[model samples]
Target: MPGNMVTSEFLVDVDHQRCRRCKRCILNCGFGVFDFQSMTTADSSKCVACHRCVVFCPEEAITIRRNPLAFREHSSWDVDKRKAVWKQAQSPGMILTGMGNDLPWLNVFDHLLIDACQVTNPSIDPLREPMELRTFLGRKPDRVEVVPSDGGYRVQNPPENNIELDIPLIFSGMSYGSVSLNVHKALAIAAEKLGTVMNTGEGGLHQELYPYRDHIIVQCASGRFGVHSDYLNAGVAVEIKIGQGAKPGIGGHLPGEKIGREVSGTRMIPVGTDALSPAPHHDIYSIEDLRQLIYALKEATGYKPISVKIATVHNVAAIASGIARAGADIIYLDGFRGGTGASPAVIRDHVGIPVEIAVAVVDAQLRSEGIRNWVSIIAAGGVRSSADVAKAIALGADAVGVGTAALIAMGCRLCQKCYTGNCSWGIATQKPELVGRLDPDWAAERLVNLVNSWSLELKEVLGALGVNAIESLRGNRERLRSLGLDAATTEIIDVKPAGR
Candidate 1:
C-alpha cells in the first residue's frame, strides 16, 4: 500500500513471473496509479481505467480489475447510482465530465429507416452513373433571374456567397487549447484535399495555418478569444458560435495551465491567464442584436458567408428561423450528444435535445415558414458513422459536422482525459511531450481516408435510395420510416412508422 488506501475501488493483479521490469506501464500512465518500485499498481482508487498501462506493458504483467465494491442492492438505486451518491457526499465539487453524455437515450437516426429501390424504381449504379454529392451551403435566393442572350438564355448568379463541397461533410471546430496543433493541421490538410471546410474553433487560427485559409471556417465564440480582422478574413467563412451541443447555456473555463507559448500567441491572451467565455453574448440581447453582429462580421470579412452555430434545444426551430431572417447564410445545429473537451456533468447530460430530432424539427420549421432555402443546415453532435451522416442528410440537413469521429480516426481512444491534458495519443494535449505522439502527415492522410470512406458509403446509400445526387436525399423525409417510436415522436420527426 502507498499510504492512501482508504478509497480503493480497483483490485490490482500482477503476474510477478511475467513482469519484465521495463517500467513501460509506469511511464505510460498519466495517473499515478501504478508503483515503480513494486512493479505493480500502487493506488487503485486513482485509476480511471484509461487502459494505457495494460496496452503498453510489454510483457502483459499487469491486470487491473474492478473491486466491485459490494453494497446492499436496491431496485430504485443501483450500484452506480449509489456510488454516485457516495462520491457526491464525499466532496461537494462540480462533476467535471469529458466527451458526450453516455445515457442510452433515443437516437432518432437508429429509429428511422431508409428506403431503397427494389422493384418499382431502379437503383442508381454508383460506379457507373454520375453520383453527385456536391453540396452548396449558404443562403439561396427565392428565385434566380434569367435573360435571353445571343447564345442562349443566361441565368444570373444568385445573391449568395455559398461554399460548394465535394461531399456534404465539414470537420467541426475543436479549439487549439482543447486539441493539439497537429490535429488542426491534419483537419486543414484533409479539408483541402477533400474540397470541404475545417473550422478554426474559438481558440483562433495559428500563423502556420494561413496557407489553408481558403478551406477554413473561422469561429467567433462568446469568449472571442482570438478575434481579429485578419483572423476573420483569413477564413472563407465565419461562424458565430452561440452555444455547443455539449454544454448549452453554460460558459467555458479553460484552465490557465494549458495556455502555452503557441496557444497564447494563437489566442492572443497572456500565457498564464485563464480563458473565460461567458454564457451569453453581451451584445446579443435579441435576434436583432444577433443580426447586427452577423452583418458586422460580414462587413469586416468582405461579405463572406456568416454562420450561426447553436445547440439543438427545445426551441431550435424558431431560433433557426430568426437566424435565417438575421442574414445568416448557414445555421449549424449541434445535438445533445456531441463531444466536448470538458463540461459540467449536469449540463452535458441533461441540457439539450438530440441532434436528429433537432435537425428534423429545424428543417421542417424553416420549410414551413417558407424560408427553407434561406440558410443551409449543418447537423452535428455525436455523428459517429457514415450511416449517421446519411441519416442526417435524409432528415433534412444539407451537411453534417464531424468532430469526435474525426478525432477517433486520428487514434483517439476516447478516454475522455482531454481536459486533464494527458492525451497520450497527441490529439488533445498542449504539452509538448504528449503532443509529439501524433504525426501530422500520417494523421492528415488518415483523415482523408476516413472522409473518402464516408463519401463512398454516402454514394452507396444514395444509390440504394434511387437518388443520383445528394440534393435528392436532402430533406426527403418521405423516404424515411421510423421504428419503435411513439406517435408524438413520429409526428414531430414527420416520418411514418414502418409498413404504414
Candidate 2:
C-alpha cells in the first residue's frame, strides 16, 4: 500500500542498527504500531502517533513525523487536521481514539483558589489538633421535635446511621472490567486503610473484593451487569450511573478480547462476544420511571440509601432537582473533564459542561426549590488536590470524588493509552504480566497518603476561611470570587471580588 494513500498510517523512519529487536516498542505501543512478523520488525500503516513506542524505545530507533504536505491546498486551517486527512483517504471514517475526554476546559481547580490561614489566625496542626474530615451522605430530618424530660430535652431516634468516611473524598466508579482486577484490589485495600469508599463502577462487583464490602459502593448502570439480590445488598451504598462525564449519551462497551474467564463469569456473559450496554435504560424513560428503579433497588436492599450519578451537562440544575424528587438520597455530578477507560476521540474531546458551573447551578436551583437539604451533592472530574475539594465544597458540593489524582498517586503517568488494554502502569489493563507490575501494598499506601495529605490541606483552607468544619463552607458563595469571570459565568456563579 502507498504510504500517502493510507490516511491512518504513521510517517515513520527507523534506524535498524539502533533497534536490537528488544520489541519494547511493539509491547508498549497500544495501537499495535510495531509488529514482529517472523524475526523482522515491521511498522503498520495505521499509527495514531501516540508517541508511546517512541518514548519507550531504549535505543531511540523510532521517529514518527506527520506529513505536512498531506493537507489539501484549499482545506481551511480551522478544520481538524486529522479529520481532514481521514476524509481525503475515503477509508472507514470513524475516528479511533483512546482514553478520556481532552478538551479546552474551564478547569475548576485553576479557577477556584483555596483559602489558607496566614500569620494572623493560627492554623491547627493536622497531626495534633482534631480536624474532622467525617462527612454524612444521607438525608437529614426536616425538623427535630424536642421533648422535655426531667433533666433536659431529648429528641427522638434520628434516621438510620449510614456509612461514615474519615474523609470527604471517595473513589469514583471505574469498574473491574474497564480497569483491572489488581486495580480493584488496590482500591478496595486503599479505601479500607483510608476509611473512605471505593466505587465498583457499573461493570459489576468482583466477589473476591466482598471482604471489603464496608468500603465498597456498588454501582448499577443501564446494563445492570452482575446485579442480583446479593450485589444489590453488598455495599454500604448503591449508585445508579445515568451518564458519565466522558461520554454522556453513549454507553460502555467492554471488548471481547479483554473479557477474560473471570470477567466473563462475573458479568455472566459469554467470553468472546462484545458486551454492549444500551444507550438508554430500556425500562426507564422519564423521571417517574427512574423513581421506580430507585424504589425497587431500595426495597431489594432493605431501604439502603441510593445515589444517582449524572454527567455535568447543560441544564444539570433542572435534572438534579428531578433526581432529588426521584427518591435518590445522594447525587453525584461528574464534570466533563472526568477520565474514562475507553472513549471515542471525538466524543471525549467534546461534550458536557464544567463541574464548577454545574455544581453552582445545581446547588442554587435546589436551594431555591427548598430541596437543597434533600440530597447530598458529590462532585467529580478533574479533582486534583485538597484545594480542589475545598473549592468544590465552597461551590456547593458536599463532597468530591478523586479518580485521576488517585491513579497518579498510584504511579500512573497519564500516557492516555488505556483503551489499548496494555497499560504499562497496570492500572487500566487486565493482562497478567502487566498487572503484576503493580504492588497492591504500595499502591494502596500511596492512595492513603494522597488522601491524608489532602485532608490536612483541607483543614488549613477551612481555618483560613474562618470556618472550623467543612459543612460551614458548603455553598458559602460569600467566601468565593470569580477572577476575570465572563458575564455568563459571573451570573451563574453569583460571586464577585471582595471590593467589587
Candidate 3:
C-alpha cells in the first residue's frame, strides 16, 4: 500500500470543460497508469510523455507536463543525485535504465574541427565526380604477389576472408527479444537494399530472415544463444561480442517475463527462461583462448572473417592490440554513450570512454604498434550523424555502427522506456498490440531514406576535402584539429590543437 500511493512527479491535466470522455487516452496507454473507475484525469506519476494518449485522443483535452518539483539548489548534491540516493535507500537494487548515458561528460566530438579544401587544392564534385564509400572489413595481405604469366603479370595470393560493405555504415546489434520482429525485418531489408550489413544482436537469425543472409552479420556473445554452425554459415561475417558499452564488466539477464514464442524460437531457448549473458566467456580466459575460438569459428564457417567486439574501457588500446594479435580480422569498439536494450543506470552512465577518444586512441596505438592494417576497426557508441561517421573514419575507423539513430529513424522517441516493453513507436516493444503499430515496409523505407541522406552528406564533406574516396579519409588526422582542448586530452586523442 505504501508503494501503491500515487506521486506527482509529472502533471497530467485534462480539460474537463470539453466533457466527452471517450476513454481513448486510457485505451491507448499501455502502462495502465490510468484509474478510470474514480479518475478525473490520467495519473501523472506514470506519464512518460510518450505522447501516445495525446496523439490518439479524439478530443484535444489532455495535456501532459512535468510537475517540476524544485529542491534547494546544491551543486554537489543535486536533485537527481539526492533522488538517486533516496531511491537506493528505499530499495537496495541497481537502478534500471535504457538508451545511452545522459550525463554531461566531455564529448570530444564537439571540440574536434574538420577541414575543407581551399582554392589552391580544387574541391571535387561528388555529384559529377566519383566518390567511393565501399569498404572491406577483414585482414589485408602484406603484399601482392606479381606472378609473370605468359606475356602479362598475374595477381596472386588474395585473402578469401572478407566482408565487403557497399557503404561505410552498419546497423549495430539490437536483438529480436529486445525489439519487435518488424524492427528486425526493417533493418534486414534496409541493409540488403543499401548493400551494407545488419547485425543480429546476440539473437539468432529468424527463419524469415534467411533470405537476407548475404547482408547479415551474426553476433556470438557470452550467452551463445541461438549459436550453431548453420547460423555461422548464414552470415557473411561472425562477430564475437566480448562486452557491451552500456554495461561493461557486468553480465546481463533478460527476465523470463519478456520471453515470447518468437524470441524463444530465435534464441533456441524455452519460453519463460531468462536469457543470461555472462560477463566473460567461460572458455575465453585470455588472448590465446580468444584466438582459439576465433580460429574455430573461422574454420567452422570455411574461413569467414571473425570480428571481436569490446567496450572502450581504460585499457582498450592494449586490449585492442591483443585482439589484433590474436587473429581477429575485425575489431569492434563500443564506447560509453552506446544504447542498450536494458542496463543498470549506474553502469550505463559511469562506465567506459567516449567513442571519439576511443577510436582516436586505439587507432594511434595500432599504428604505433605497426599492426593498424592487420585488422579493420568499426567505431560504435553514440554515432549520431554523418558528421560522426566521417569523423570516425578520419579517426581511423573503417566504418561506424549506429543503433540508437537507426531506432529513431524507425520512429523511436528515446523515451528511455525500452526496459518496460511498451514502446508506442513499435520499434522497441514486443507486445502484440504495440508491435502491430509498426509497418515493416514503411519502416524500411524510412531507414533507407535516413542512410541514403547521411551517405550523401558524407560525400559532400569528402568532396569539400578534395577527397574522392572515403578510404583516403581514414587515419588522416591532419584534416582534423582541436578547437580548444587541454594538452593531455588532445594528446590522448592524438589530434593537434588549433593554429599549429
lDDT, candidate 2, residue 422?
71
Global local distance difference test of model 2: 0.80
TM-score: model 1 vs. ground truth: 0.94
Q: What is the lDDT of residue 276 in candidate 1?
A: 93
Q: Model 2, range 1-500, lDDT digits (tens) per residue? A: 55464344447666787788888877776555577765325464656565657777889998877645455555445336555465657665555455456555566457655555677877655455566668888776766778887899888745453568788899999888778888888899999998889999987888899899999999998888888889878899899899888878888788887788888877777886677888788888899999999999998999888999999889899999999999899999998888888776667778898888899899999999998878999999878778778878888998898888888887676657677787766788878777776798888888888888888888877766656778888898777776666667777877664355
TM-score of each: 0.94, 0.86, 0.94
After superposing candidate 1 on the true structure, give the runs of residues whose Cα lies further than 4 Å from its correct spot. Answer: 1-14, 38-42, 60-67, 146-154
**Model 1: per-residue Cα lDDT at residue 356:** 91
Instruction: List RMSD in Å for every model shown.
Output: 2.4, 3.9, 2.3
TM-score of 2: 0.86
**1-500, model 1: which lDDT tens digit per residue?**
33432355566666779988887777776666778665554577766666777878788888878787776778888666666666676677777878887777887888888889999989988999989999999989898888888979887865568898899999998999989999999999999999999998899999999999989999999899889999999988999999999999888888888899999999999997999999998899799999999999988988999999999999999999999999999999999998898898889999999999999999999999999998999999979888899889889999999999999889887767688888767777898977887898899899999999999998999999999999998988888999998899999989989998
Per-residue lDDT over 95-151 for candidate 3, one digit per residue giving the tens place of the 0 to 100 score: 898889999998888888889999899999999998999998999887778899899
Local accuracy by lDDT, each model? 0.88, 0.80, 0.88
Q: What is the alpha-carbon lDDT of model 3 when measured against the actual structure?
A: 0.88
Candidate 1 residue pairs that clash: none
